[model samples]
Target: MSRPFLKMNGLGNDFVVVEARSKPFAPSAEDVRAIADRERGVGCDQLVSIEPSARADAAVRFWNADGEEVGACGNASRCVGWLLMEASGRDEAVIETRAGLLKATRAGERRVSVDMGEPGLRWDQIPLAEEMDTKGIELQVGPIDAPHLHTPGCVSMGNPHVVFFVPDAEAAPVREVGPLIEHHPLFPEGVNVGFAQIKARDRIRLRVWERGAGLTRACGTGACAALVAAARRGLTDRKATLELDGGELVIEWREADGHVIMTGPAEVDFTGTLP
Candidate 1:
C-alpha cells in the first residue's frame, strides 16, 4: 500500500511526516527503519506521524532513525503543527506528544512557534542512575588518564539531555566526547549530549550528539535544554537565541507559566509517495 509523506525540516533537522490522524498506523521497529533508510527508503532524521488526540488537538508520535519511539521532538512538533494547520485551516493548534501537550502557532510564512511546556530539572526527572543535582553531575569520558569532559548539567525537555557548558562550543570535543557522554554510566537511558558555548547574555552556540541519531544539523529540545540549564545557573537571560550547527532558535522560559516557548522556522522540502 502506498502512503503519502511530506519531507520537512526545522533548522535542517529533517523529518518524514506521515499524517495518520484519521487512523493509527503503528509501524514496527523494522518498518520504521525501512522508512528512514537513506538509500532504500524515505530517509529522515526522524519519522513523525500525526494521530487523533484525546485532548482536542493532535497526537504526534516520533521515531528516530534507529526506529525507537521517542518521548519528544521539537522540530517534528513544528512539522506536525504545520501539517495540522494546513489540513484544518487553523492558525493555531495544540499537539500532544509522548512528553506532553505543546501549543503551536503559525508565526510566519514558513515558521512556527511552539510552547514546549516546562522543563524537568530533578535528578530523577532526568532519570539518571544516581541522585545528583541537575545543576552539575560528575560524568567523565575520554582517556582514563586524562578525561576530556566532566560535570555536565542534566535536564529533560520531555527527553534526556546532558549539556556541557564550555568556553567555545566550536573547540569543544563534540565528536570525541559526545558519544562517550551519551553512553556514560550516569545516564541509564542513553542521552543526547550537547556542547554549549555561551556567547553573550542572550546568544549561544550549540552542537548536539543525539541519542538515537548521531550528530545532526540541529536539535530543538536540545537547544531548549541548554537554555534552561544556562538560565538556572544565572548564566543567561530567560530568553536567548540559540545558534545550532544548522540554524538559530529563539527560546523563552516564561516566568508566568514556567513554560519554555521555542520559536523557529519549519520548511517543507518535498513530498514523497510510499511505494
Candidate 2:
C-alpha cells in the first residue's frame, strides 16, 4: 500500500510527514530508517507523524533519521502547524507532543512563531546524570588547565541541550566533539550539543549536533535552547536572533509568561507517496 506524505522544511531542517489522523500509521524504528534513507527513500532529518488529538488540534510525533522517536522537534512543529492551519483555514494551531502542548501562529508571510513553553532549568528537569548548576554545569573538553569547551549552560526546551559559548561557531569542532558530548554520561537521556558564537547582544551564530540526527543545517529546539542558555549566562539578551547553518530564527524568552517563542520560516520541498 502507498501512503501519502508531505516533504517540508523549517529553515533547512527537513521532515517527511505522514498523516495518521484518519488512519493509524505507526512505523517501526527500522521502517522510519528505511523511509529516511537518502538514496533508498525520501531523505529527511526527522520523520513526523500527524495523529488525532483530544487536547489539542492534533497530535504529533518526531523520529530522527536514526529511527529514534523523540519528545519534540522545533522545526518539525512549525511545519506541522502550517499544515494544520492550511487545512483548517485558521491562523493558529495547537499540537500535542511528548514534550507537551505547543501553540503555533502565523508570523508574517512564510514564517511561523511557535510558543516552545518554559525551559527546564533545574538539574532534574534537564535530567542530567546528577545535580549540577544549570547556569554553567561542571563539564569540559581538553586539558584541565585550559579546556577547549567548558562550563556550558544547560536547558530543556522540551529536550535536553548543552550550549557551549565559543568565540567562533564556524571554528568549533562540531564533528569531532559533538558525538563525545552527546553520549556523555552526564546527560542520562543523551543531549543536543550547540556550539554558539555570540555576535552581539541580539544575534548569535550556532551549530548543533542533534542527539540522534547528527549535524544538520538547522535545529529549531537547538536555536531556542541557545537563546535561553545565552541569556542565562548573560552573554546575550533574553530575545535574540540565532543564525543557524540553514537560516536564522528569532527567539524570545518572554518575561511575563516565561514562555519561549521561536519564529522562523517553513517551506515545502515536494510531496509524494511512500510505497
Top candidate when judged by TM-score against the true structure:
2
Give one digit per residue, the lDDT tens place, for model 2 in 1-275: 79999999998899999999999998999999999999998999999999999999999999999999999899999999988989988999999999999999999887899999999999999879999999999999999999999999999988999999999999999999999999999999999999999999999999999999999999999999999999988889999999999999999999999999999998999999998
Lowest summed lDDT window (length 10), candidate 1? 140-149
Give the Å error, residue 144, model 1: 7.5
Cα TM-score per model: 0.96, 0.99
| Tens digits of per-residue lDDT for model 1, 1-275 | 77888999999999988879776678999888898898999888999888888895888899999989999999889878877787789999899888988989998987889999999999998889998988988776667778667678888999999999888888988787787777878888889999999999999899999988889899999999999999988889999999998899999999999999999988899998867
Q: Scored by CA lDDT, what does every candidate get?
A: 0.89, 0.95
Which RMSD does model 2 reach against the true structure? 0.7
